[model samples]
Target: MSRRLVPLALTLALGLAPVVAVTTGATAGQAERRAAPSRTVDLPDGWQPEGVTTGRRGKVYSGSLADGSILRLNPRTNRTVVLPDSAVGKPSVGLDYDKRRRILWVAGGPEGEIRAVRLGTGEVLRTYTLPAAANDRFVNDLVVTSGAVYATDSANQELGVVELPAGLTLPPSGAATLLPLTGELVYQDGFNANGIVESNRGNWLVLVQSNTGRLFRVNAATGRTLQIDLDGRRVRNGDGLEAKGDLLYVVRNANNRIDVYDLKRNVRSGDRVKVIRTPDFDTPTTATVVRRSLWVANARFGVDDPETASYWLTRVDR
Candidate 1:
């Protein structure tokens, strides 16, 4: 079996603070202020939370490594319950829910399997094995829309879109092959696009290079791509990305921080720049903005110790 090799393609940015002030539309001004930071809830013993998503009812579903389980964190009751245990048999990297079907989809992890589990009865309704020429390929992070699920392939250096049909099987066709990242433009060691999120503008997909910290915008209709960051330099080890309205939140892995960029604030060459930096994080790997608050998954594994990995979930006020 093939395994991924590590390379020093990351940089650390430290001692920075939020510097940009955002002015929004008149209607947005009337909206309430973003929520304040909340107390971090440590997971139960052996429950290593990796990814988080909010359910239709505002409940938080945290993906855990302990038993490959999803846990519903009920803050009001101060209780956690293992949910959608069908995920227990699979290695789940990222978790997101489809409100229309009430199905929870988890990106493939070590096993390269994407699963759709019914939240109502905790049954795995379907599974899709990633098709790859490389044996070590796996799905990293994913974003689900009304029609399809777009997942990033770290090992194979590709992007895959899995369509959701009734009964949910891997589509017989319609998988997309993204434009290859090569030459001096490619970030990381051969296009390791680890994190993926939809553009705040709601039309494009933002793919982050884990090793190089470069961001690329992928066209939804055509697989054609453009580098969002023109410099081809590291912004921090870009791990996971989350877009809440016009703001894009990115997890800076090497720096152990979360950085926010305003999509509307373009400074040079029509590219958005990082404006806020929140440090004091431990290998912060992925972020999700829910309930007007930002949640981070601290993987706790960095350049210092890439072999051993552990994680916890934390929240920050916007």
Candidate 2:
């Protein structure tokens, strides 16, 4: 589901802290040498961004929920550019950059559409309309793999799959398929499958259940799932997921924090290694690691007004 529509009263009911310190043991000098200089990059007012991904040459990409426009940010130079209108007009929730094909796969929230945009020219190459009943689908996030692209439907119990042809060629429209989720994972009242990532060397896909605060390991081919044990810790309100080697980062939206987990070799279990919190986070929805730092997109849900409110990206040193 698009979190922008979640009521403000529900957010207040969570009683999340406004700030939580990120603890580290390294000396100040050592930390400064290892970490990049922390900073913020302001987005267009009312951008209402939810997703973030890093591209070649240190370029950071995010999509605006308000207009479906894609914004490109160069953190090093602090420059910004808005992509063409070919992919605009639909809410863009999550996106991934395809290095092999130089395409940016964007999830069309509530529209049940996935668009492939050329990274260099901003031309929308193709828009695939996922098969689902009207008003019953919310294409939340997507992850690209070697042979296919998998997307989550926050409002349903199935995943939208787009199989790429040989040579990583984009498939024709109406070629997408649906993979029904089975096993321990269940769809609840609110958002169910929100974020997805491939782990265990691409043998397993890890998914976060937003409403239940549970992580599940899914068989990519069979769609069978098993709940991941998180050492009794729950990542409630988890929105976007990022996996780096054996480490997984879960962005807990309402809590204003990101939880890092150390996953086991089989990806069936994990231990919470750290909690990343900052005052700058205003309902951060997703993140991408760049040069030892995490660039987070603040969705700022529940603000008094979204159309005129300020929006920005917070760069936290990991």
Candidate 3:
């Protein structure tokens, strides 16, 4: 299949899926609505954009897997600015903003380290060595809040939390703890525990287990876990997660769909899911919300396209 056609097909597939029941624990008014495309940005050739973030400057920033490069795309102009030496060979996934420090934090793949870069200059500011794990331990999704950084250790199928000091520097302090991975979500082929979104309410963190298509809620401060199934079936490779105020947005890669969970409404809270169509793509790895829209990183597997993997940092306005 051609790379250009994947996302379009997926978007159509999403439009056809049945709607799941929404629950009360979901974000407010998010479940009742479907997202329509607001705008689109085509990535540069030979670039697979992953780990995207929207800067306060009104540009989208994403990491490139091919060369460990970082790109800043200005949506208004459709022009891209490549950051020199931004790409790292190891997968760079999960981007979290430290507004207090004016920097962004990234998790490297499989026992790799955590890196921080200044938003203003794009300079590498700090690098923290990740604790070793028995499995590959790909540090996938991450979120920063209350001076603590919580990242998903996917290969190990757990979540790791590292505390960041107020000043922001390399080698963040505190110990790493493993968060449990369990839920009613089904296990599917081709993916594992992926994206995570920290709930704005209390110390709760919601995790999307890509392999099993499950959603888990964990207490960030205590590491306690609660498993909730999205209806009864497994969610598609739930790769991307972003929470804005009362709503949480989830991206299912295989389904090529996005689901919005309204935290406020009682009927659609924690258990229900409604599909929102996304642009055409083979695999969507991650998503971040910037301004009012969502940015998605669509990466095709190597087997799908041996010569090169066509990826996009697509912007969804809905």
RMSD list, candidates in order? 8.5, 4.8, 6.6
Candidate number of the best TM-score: 2
TM-scores, in order shown? Answer: 0.74, 0.89, 0.78
lDDT, each prediction: 0.60, 0.83, 0.64
Quality of model 3 by C-alpha lDDT: 0.64
- The ten-residue window of minimal lDDT in model 1 covers 1-10
- What is candidate 1's lDDT per residue for 130-245, written digit by digit as tens? 66545476677788776678787777655566765666444543334343444323534443677777765646777777666667777656655666654444554677787776
lDDT of 3 by residue, 23-86 (tens): 5576545643443554556666667655777676767778766655678788778887777656
Evaluated at residue 185, the lDDT of candidate 2 is 98
lDDT of 1 at 261: 63
Q: State the local distance difference test value for candidate 2.
A: 0.83
Q: Residue 132 deviation, candidate 3, in Å?
A: 2.3
Highest lDDT scorer = 2
**Number of clashing residue pairs, candidate 3:** 31
